[model samples]
Target: MQGYKKETELLTKLLLEILPILKAQYNLEEYQSKDFRTGDIACMKSLLSRLKHLKTSKFFSTASSDEDLKLKLKVDAYEKTAKNDQKVIAILKNKEKGLEQRIRELEKANKEAVALKKSMERKDEKLREVMRYNTVLKAKLEC
Candidate 1:
């Protein structure tokens, strides 16, 4: 995009320098003096068409011959690529942050589950001790 603007400005500058010569060569001075009639419209249209052709020719010729234009185009492409790379890096950083948060959450849940298992095992041991004492009491009562 930047390259295009530079090229446009250069073409416009070049055309401004060349327009007078072309106008004189084409004898448009006489047409300019004509009154604003139907003839003026037709004459202006012809001049406009000629100007378009000149602009196209000059633009293509300059684009082919200008080293500065080619260099600007390359620089613009490099800047665009750099910008895209930065964007991709930013997105990857965001994903990395999300994955790290998920890993932390999973670690917390695992710790809680381990603590609960330990508590359940202690309860089960106490229940087994109570059952053994009840059997001893029943045996003495029967004797």
Candidate 2:
């Protein structure tokens, strides 16, 4: 009886760890389409099969109300995790938009500075002509 209890205890712990982790990994973009790796799928399937077997056996009843209570708590936790995931995704999207706008503003400022530099270069040509004219007049007066 102790051996059976220990086996189920270990399996229950394994089940507790597997379900949420598999659910999270399965939803990732890399696994969204036909891109899901065979190995990951196989592992998930194995875990699910074991979980099903554990839940159905007489051994499951050994823990009685404890298992049922734990399951309810785990489900509640998962529900809250879903909401948190959505909030995180929304915040990330907002951050990305802000970063993109900042990049556009920086690019615009760079273009305007370049244009101002070209305008100054054009004015510098005329200024050189005026300086030359003044120097010639000064030399003529001295002579």
The TM-score leader among the candidates is 1
Clashes of each: 0, 0
Model 1 steric clash pairs: none
Model 2 residue 105 lDDT? 100
Q: What TM-score would every model get versus the actual structure?
A: 0.50, 0.49
Candidate 1 residue lDDT tens string, 6-57:
6545645544443444445445464443322223445545665775575476
Candidate 1 yields a Cα-based lDDT of 0.62
lDDT of each: 0.62, 0.62
Clashing pairs in 2: none
lDDT of 1 at 76: 50
Clashes in candidate 2: how many? 0
